[model samples]
Target: MKIPERYQPKNNKSFASYWQPTKDNLLPFLLPKTNISDSEKLVPYYFKVDDLADEVAVEYFTNTPFNQAIAKLHTDFSLFPSNKNRLSLATQNLFQQLNEVPSWVDFDLVNLGTSYCNRTGTAALSVLRNYCLMGGYESSAINKPLIFTQALHKGAVKRLADTVDFWMYVTEINGLKPNNKGIYAVLTTRLIHAYSRIQIEKKSEWKSELWGRPINLWDMLATNLGFSIAFIDGLSKLKFKPTAKELEAVLHLWKYVGYLMGIPLHLLPNTGEEAAKQLFLWSKSQKGIDTDSKQLAWALYDEPLRVTFTKNKIMKWFVQKTNLGYNEVLLGTESRQELALPYSKAKYWILFLNKINEYFDTKAKSNPDYYNKIAKQGRKAQEKVWKLYQQAK
Candidate 1:
């Protein structure tokens, strides 16, 4: 698909030349017309057709007997034996949609990306936990249903499981392939989001202007960008810089993942730089923060800490302190003020620790044993987070 003229980068400049790492670039994009109605609405210009396609898929899954079996499996995996026929039928019906792996995907690049994620370790977790969570809350489209249902607080374990499954897919071998655990998890999430959209749209209180359809294409793109572009930016702020090649591999990994998750090809950028620009454009198009944004942001910020650290005050304090610093730096002043996060001396300490870790990481990259050790540490941390999710449940 040809890129839209408006969406194309200005002057046809390469993203590296077009993007500047400065305060101006970090600031949110401003829409040209401030007073226009629906300024806050994130209409999927590039992917409207794809959105329609997804809607059809959702309708089929929701109305079919296959969905019943899927739900049963969710409740008890042991029931899979009884539902084998239904599961087979459902898998066959969804095969073409779920089986596709983009022709452009490079397994080597995916492995490179996975390695980079492993190397970054806890720094990546900080970004996923704080920065991405903050972005989700900032979006009125995402925040409303979450806030209205109190899902972040009440369904914390299920929510965390979904997140863990996502990371495992991106980081695991052959994760994006059809019938793999990662791909299956991704498909299930797509169905769940589609189901949520259908259920939420039926409510009288669900405002189309603010909420859009649940999991609209635009919102999905924004969420994907958070994990890719915004995530890398967050890591950079923490002084953990990936090589340009490593960064590109990370983008490549997520681009394919986005494709599997039903985001259109036109909307998925080939490079991290373009992804950043896309995020900025999407952010500028949205309306200012609302009550729902604030409520949801605060709840997400507090709930995970409360749930995970309940037994150890010292551990909770340390995580909270580091998290606060990371969120402040990544979210920037505007988001911090909007979310009402307080300024802290801990930010200075956080940066210092990041620089110290970066030095060690740089040295460790040359030593295979050290590299393997950190990778194991990173995996262990992920397992701990998964355990926390289970405990929270």
Candidate 2:
């Protein structure tokens, strides 16, 4: 499909400002029924997996001994040419693909993005947990058997930890390098998705669906927007306003992340307004929330509370109250009703008071110390949650 002219980024200050979303700008965040015809048209560009399945590529990735060798070479670049001739043709091809970073990457912007994330601290985690994860589940395409079984049904705390790890790795500079842990983690995930598509398509259940593939280009783009656009929106609703540059840097950071995750570049938005347009398009393309979506949403909402609020009644009460307010305000009333979550006046007031505290805290002290304290607390909490998950199993 040809890119819309208005969605294209313009080279002017007016065109570059942070998008202010109005009521009219807000799209109905419902999943749409899949259109087979539309899916077919996008398959070649968006869901191409031939490269991943190439005989040589598959052998290199699948062979345990060869994978060990590649890991050694990856950790110590000095070991590359030593096994250069011993390496299979497939291994060579895979190596090149792994090293290929997008030409558009701006290191300065990447650093700025890191700083922006640092400034946001634990608040970013709240946005990610409450908004992005919940919003992702709202997509029926994403809530299908493959993902639902592999992720949502597999303990929420584990799922949340895995997601947090991804965000942390992607934003860190060391994680962006070729053959690094972050790149490997993302590529491994992409391969898993491709494998899931192949396996799921053969099933009677998936074949009956309008879209043939389990994860398509539209779904990938929507998921990307959840991390970028939806995350920023969540932060804004929480009263944590980022500077224009910080916003752009964060989007740019995720743009590179999308590129690494195998999303087609053309589908990614260059500006917040363009992102909003793309999100609206995605929402219009989906059927409304399904049973799977509701199941996943409820799990996502309740599991974190269950794990985090094991003790400290007052703290647990505050967190749950604030979370309810965050969901109601950010997810919209329709989504709240759809998820069967009730509005709590106490929660709304709790959120208001917390926002006031956040503002005053910022005004009273430099944020580095505050950010450090929050990060420390978050780390401890995540570790405890991880331990609990392990214990339950």
Candidate 3:
């Protein structure tokens, strides 16, 4: 929801100065459902072979190889990507924690999924499996929760498409109308960025001129869709039975993404890297544009500048191209609201269980004491459920 500009922090203040949760801000700290229990019966959801992903994501917050590194950078994005060595180290740390998975995989999909929980929903069964390809993991460590056997054929690309669909859902829920071309525009922008990142990383090419070009709005919209849907999935899970700590962890992670995505500091979404200092500064300066819609509009307007840092001359080129981009928006766009909903099957329950443990493992390692307290009780409760399932098995 949008708020008036008068109440927001302006004058180019840091996000740290304005990042507080208020009733109508971007991401309010969500309270968990009161009726949660580990013993509740689970439904089924299945996995597919076409995606061929790991059984589950590595618990970067727990286990060996990368926990410490992740712990170090968990809240600090600046230091992690500071240099090639640091990036390598950060990637290595993640690799070890994640059973030696590729770095691109970590950032592109898995972390993106974790980030979704922060943006749209809480980190729960279907949510995690949907993001990290839980059915692909090899360990039982990934399979300690509710198991489903229904088929779900989704991938990173499909996730990108669904993100667009989810955003349409949220806007409808809020009684607001969506931009007809918004989702497609956003998706297109994301594709460009994704492609750019790949080319830059693989070819070691850095064109200063390219940096200033206005983002293909379609691609950026898709990126936002990815974020919002993930957040929605994570949040809806909270509406179901979830632990207090899980709620807290999910809340914490959500803030992180909100901040990174230039969410208003006062919106109360969640925290992100302190390195986002400049972006947050811009957000603070626009505090005058308050309501959720206005704030979102203002933020969206600021996106191109953020995409090209002030140091990049190309930003000027992008600014000049704004008219071209604006004209494109006038074209008729598709309304995803009418699209048929994707089916949720029974086999997915297995993948869902695996994801829950994966989420727990990451949360536990990130905050051992917190996870331990819950683990003691959770383990016992889990064993009881396991015995019951075995009997059925």
lDDT of each: 0.62, 0.59, 0.28
| Per-residue C-alpha lDDT of model 3 across residues 1-393, encoded as one tens digit per residue | 222222233333212212334322222233222221210111000111101001111222224443353344333322333443644443344323322222222223322333233222222223332321211111111111101110122112233234333333222211111222332222222233333333332332332222211122211222232233333322333232323433344344333333222233343333222212322322233322112222222232333343322446575445424412321111101100111111223224433543664565556546647554544544344334334323322
The candidate scoring highest on TM-score is 1
Top candidate when judged by lDDT against the true structure: 1
Per-residue lDDT value at 43 in model 3: 7
**Candidate order by lDDT, highest to lowest?**
1, 2, 3
Q: Tens digits of per-residue lDDT for model 2 on 200-241?
A: 665666632344345666677778888887787776666655
RMSD of 1: 6.6
lDDT of 1 by residue, 1-393 (tens): 332222322332212211335532331221122332332233544324244434544545565676674565343323334444655444443445556555788988886777777777667777787777765565554556675555755654456556866786667756766567776677667766665666666778866544455566776887788777777776666666667777798888888878877787788888755676577666554554567677666665565456643688777667667777777667665677677666666778777777786785686566778876776777677667666665665
RMSD of each: 6.6, 7.6, 22.4
Better of 2 and 3 by TM-score: 2
Q: Please report, as a residue range, the 10-residue window in candidate 2 with the lowest summed lDDT.
A: 8-17
